[model samples]
Target chain A: MSAFKKIIPLFDRVLIQRVKAAERTASGIYIPEKAQETLNEGLVVAVGPGAFVDGKLQPVALKNGERVLLPPYGGSAVKVGSEEYLLFRDSEILAKLE
Target chain B: MSAFKKIIPLFDRVLIQRVKAAERTASGIYIPEKAQETLNEGLVVAVGPGAFVDGKLQPVALKNGERVLLPPYGGSAVKVGSEEYLLFRDSEILAKLE
Candidate 1:
């Protein structure tokens, strides 16, 4: 992979790599792709300075390389470096993975 | 309009009415619809209880009748009655309008 990628998400948006969904459920049932939610786990590659607050910039709470669980409905799909990444605002992140 | 709508967002999801965009700028220049960001103002019609936490439910911070500002991305398109509503999780809301 190249050392640098030009795509930097602007304004509180975080760039993430979507984790693949498991093919089968714990009960050993094969679930169809459409039945499952697209919301997935990911590694934060880059994050913008937190959303504007009272005309001031707040520091982003999430750091690069942290795993995150995103909400299903946010973010736009973009292809980068042979992988797919979703760009969404910091507020769009549903939870952080331990 | 019917007194009760069959749609209710589940598990921290919310239902909102989308605000219309202004076609012309204050400068009197004609702006294309696609040129502007989709994030717009809205009113909270219904909101979920809250997202899961250690297998327990948390109370949603937003109320049913408050005005909100949703992030540019997030929420799915759905039509109910004579208006349009976006269905998305609480995290998808970028800000609460004053």
Candidate 2:
């Protein structure tokens, strides 16, 4: 957590950690690496100040600890030690998961 | 131009046409396709209504015909007939070229 805190996204950017895929099914069937379905779900870790609009700075809508849906592709990948994270603009996020 | 008008970007999304790379140098040296360097510049074609913030919609900063810098990656590619365009959030645009 301390490592991720060191990162401060700029201008409507949001930092997120991708949720890992399930290694096994409910019946205890192990899924192979290639067979695992990659989910586009993520947890918001940090958010940047909103971008300037009409010469004024706006506030971002997303907040820390929120679960979000990610697009199939895009976003900048960031590495913190062995942990990986993603940086995307608040607008790039598809939706918020309830 | 009429064809591009059909596209209406949603939420802070921008429609852009990538600037073509130069095939020849000022010295008239022909550069092969493999040697051609792809540029990250684009011409703004269309823009979406600003995303909602604080229960109100803000307006996008970029306007049509503006030259902009694009990120090395990201953006959704759209094909209209033989022409290709890219859709990206206004915030994804790096800088506006003067």
Candidate 3:
């Protein structure tokens, strides 16, 4: 949390940590690393103040800890220590997961 | 203009046509296709009504016909007949060229 706090996304940008895919099957069968599917899901770690429009600052709809569906590609990747994070504009995010 | 008018971007999205790079050198040398550099500049064709925030509709800062700097990547490509266009969120646009 402290590491994430250091990142302040600017102008409708969001910081997200990708949610890892499951390593095993329901029956407990191990899935090899090569066979793992890369997921486009992530958790919102930080959100920027909304972009300004017509001289007013609009607030972004996203909140911290929300699960989100990411686009196939496009976010800027940032490495903090050994963890990787992504920065995307609120509009670039495909959808908010329930 | 009529062809471009057919595209109406939604929700803070913008439609842009990339500016083409020069095909000849200052000395009147014809630059081959392979040597041509793709430009990251574009003309704004259309803009969405802006995304809704806190129950109010905000307007994007960009205007049609404005020359803008585009990100190197990230935009949905659309083909209108033989002409190519790109759709990107307003925030995805890097800057406005004077």
Best by lDDT: 2
Ranking by lDDT: 2, 3, 1
* TM-score of the A-chain for all models: 0.72, 0.91, 0.91
lDDT of each: 0.70, 0.82, 0.81
Model 3 fnat value: 0.00
True contacts kept of each: 0.00, 0.03, 0.00
In the order shown, the candidates' DockQ scores are 0.03, 0.04, 0.02
TM-score of candidate 3 to 2 decimals? 0.51
Off by over 4 Å in 2: A1-98, B1-5
Give the 10-residue window scoring lowest on summed lDDT in candidate 1 chain B: B1-10
Model 2 per-residue lDDT tens digits across residues A1-98:
11223565657788899999999998999999899999999999888777876657878879999999999998877654578788888899999999
Q: Clashes in model 1: which pairs?
A: none
Q: Which regions of candidate 1 deviate over 4 angstroms?
A: A1-6, A23-39, B1-98
- Report the TM-score for the A-chain of model 3: 0.91
TM-score, prediction 1: 0.42
Model 1 DockQ, alpha carbons vs. true complex:
0.03
Q: Which docking category, incorrect, acceptable, medium or high, applies to candidate 1?
A: incorrect
